[model samples]
Target: MSAFLAPIHSWLFNKVLLFQDIEMDLRNKYLEIYGEEAREIIEETKNYGELIDRTKSIEELIDLSNIHGWLQNKIQNGESRVAVILSIFIDKYGSDALKTAEDIFYNNGIKQGQMAKEKENPQNAKDIFSTLNNYILEGMPCDRVQKLIQADEHIVRWINTSCVHRGNFERANADINLFYKLRFLYLKGFVSSANEEYKFFETNNEDDYIYNIEKA
Candidate 1:
């Protein structure tokens, strides 16, 4: 059973589902705001990827013969869909769309963070970071998007080895810097709820991105 679809496979699938859920929530919000206009906005942004059948488990839905590629495709699909939606919204409605999207990401992050804290009882910065990773979509583990630089009981630091979302954003014609801004909101919300005494910060070090989680 482990060979066909391991725990990490299921873990990544759940992350994909989380992104889908967030995207749908953003879509529904637009639907309510724009009424019939949203249909066309969403339609114009279509074909980035297909949504999965929510009723089925990953084991039931995955292509067993090409498990890695299948999961990778879904991850890319999810990333592309998000970038397109955000891009389209910003182009059509400007700051209004951006504000709504920002709220959705931050609220979802807080929700995930609180759930992680309640379920895992994370005691320190490292524990909080581990639990947060379970919810955020950072591509497959093999991508090595982040590498741990240092860690102690009170602090855990990592450097971005690569970015998985950049290509999708570029393909969608979205502002990559805006994506990071929205993502920062999500992280801020997550850390605030995940642990009140801890904070998450992003810094630049000679063209590299550094992420730090430590006690406040």
Candidate 2:
């Protein structure tokens, strides 16, 4: 919203678009990185023109919107267990979680997957974000489910890296199934820690969906 934040937001918006316009080797990288739903969506549209047409119909439009939100939800699910572990760290070790996060990501054996594919091409950025936006405001976007085996390589790597750096064996053996819930905030644009306490109160949107971020 503010001028300073706008650039970073715009950059991320475009970065997400990179996912939509993905093609060739780059697209394959995304397919590998995102796994099932992203692969299905990529297979369905292949190009920006196809995605645009697919999004034109009202019914189709909602389905597309769900793709982005659902993807984020999926990611949030993926990272949930890691988050819970982090929370326990916070509880037991206080603010040491921040240091832990840095150490985990900043070391060797922590593989760096190819992120340059999208960053090199701006058009790809636009495409990914457009599809991501289309999916955010609608129903479930991607029905594709990623196989546990498909996502495990990167998962195991990160988990091990964290474990080795923290000197904590439990981190290496942490559950993977529960971690997929972590949202893809690059597309969603908000990074909320699971530590943020949430208190629930009932609400009726009539349509039976929840959208409001802040509840009073």
Candidate 3:
């Protein structure tokens, strides 16, 4: 009886250990595949929620302004891939990633401008603008940066004719006012440091935005 019981016990113990090992491997593989997908979903979902809230708050402004119908529709569409990328960065590196990236771009722009100022033959406005542009491009993926540049051109156009949007913006209580102010301040700082006045004007050509630099 003792011999029979010993064999039975040994078989049961080995099977239990094998089952545990299989379970552990399955858990690890599941995490390996699903973990990244889970994180992406979380960030995308959060960005969607934030964008929806922002759109809701600014709906009145959108309705009142001279903004293009396509732009209004786009904003209302709630399909901001930039927001998702930003959210991923924030999740992995913490919210401070935003400030850090901004500082990198801003400080480099200032440094380039200052270096130009110190030289007897300072860099021209076009060169300075290129430096600032490169700084921004360095911190983002190329495709995303291209999209940003296009959006920025639109924003510059809007601000150049700000009379169209100012009243609606003022009444809507939107945070875009901060962006409007910051653009002027940023350009002003570049102009001051580089010892140049860069003037942007609309043109009749296909690529309508052009800038002229003058001695300060």
Using lDDT, give the best candidate's number: 1
Q: Which of 2 and 3 is ahead in TM-score?
A: 3
Q: Which ten residues in a row have the lowest lDDT in candidate 3?
A: 135-144
Relative to the true structure, how large is the alpha-carbon lDDT of every model?
0.84, 0.28, 0.35
Q: Superposing all C-alpha atoms, what RMSD in Å does each candidate have to the true structure? A: 1.7, 19.0, 24.4
Q: Where does candidate 1 clash, by residue pair?
A: none
Greater TM-score among 1 and 3 belongs to 1
| Candidate 2 lDDT for residue 46 | 23
Cα lDDT tens digits, model 3, 1-216, are 122223423333332232223223323333354577535543543432233222232334333333334233333222222233334444555545444434433343454456556643335544544444422211112112222122231122211211222332233332333323333334445445655444322233343223333345
lDDT of 1: 0.84
Q: What does candidate 2 score on TM?
A: 0.23
Please estimate how well model 3 matches the true structure, expressed as its whole-model Cα lDDT.
Answer: 0.35
Worst 10 residues of 1 by lDDT: 41-50
RMSD of 1: 1.7
Model 3, runs deviating above 4 Å: 1-112, 115-122, 136-174, 196-212
lDDT string, candidate 2, 1-216, tens digits:
232332423343333333233213233443454467445544433221222232343333323434344334322332333333433343444444434433332221011111322232212222322223322212122322211121221111001111111211133343332221112222123201111121112134453222222211
* Ranked candidates, highest TM-score first: 1, 3, 2
Off by over 4 Å in 1: 1-3
